[model samples]
Target: MPKLEPEIADEAPCSAEFTAYDEEHLVTYLRLLDAETDGADWREVARIVLRLDPAVDPDGARRCWESHLKRAKWMSGYGYRYFLKKPRGS
Candidate 1:
């Protein structure tokens, strides 16, 4: 039930660092996907889900949501292969 922290909100497009982070924050990514799928407002998602204030940092919040959402899509489409390669609890 861990939540995304404000400090590490911004996610990279792709990288070893981001891959590791994505694994740790998989739940957050899933939540993002769910929100997007449900057509939730990015502004609301930013404030409630991401614990960010779009009014204070609109660009940063938007970038954070978009980047994480993009990575989440990547996980669904291709990044799941990473988990397949390494068995869980290995």
Candidate 2:
């Protein structure tokens, strides 16, 4: 799995435009969704998948997961349209 920057996870100001970073981290978003579906604990996901040490900064880790997960949901629901609208072979 591609590792996400801790800063991006911690303070994701989800942009309206689909960025290269978003494209790069697409798998991470998918994993987040799968974890949610499987009822996996956020704390565990943060530690294992997201590589966040919740014990060191519980609030920050939670915020990271929540924001990233929210962005992932938004991508699935609405942001994908941006991708579809792009010309092929960009």
Candidate No. with top lDDT:
2
Off by over 4 Å in 2: 1-8
Q: Residue 77 error for model 2, in Å?
A: 0.3
Question: In angstroms, how far off is 64's CA in candidate 1?
Answer: 0.6
Please provide TM-scores, in order, for all candidate models, with all chains considered together: 0.80, 0.81
Give the TM-score (vs. native) of candidate 1. 0.80
Native-vs-model 1 lDDT? Answer: 0.74
- Candidate 2, residues 1-90, lDDT tens digits: the string is 234532354655489888766666777788888999999999998887678899999999999899879888988998779778867766
Clashing pairs in 1: none
Global CA lDDT of candidate 2, please? Answer: 0.78
Q: Stretches of candidate 1 above 4 Å error? A: 1-7, 16-18
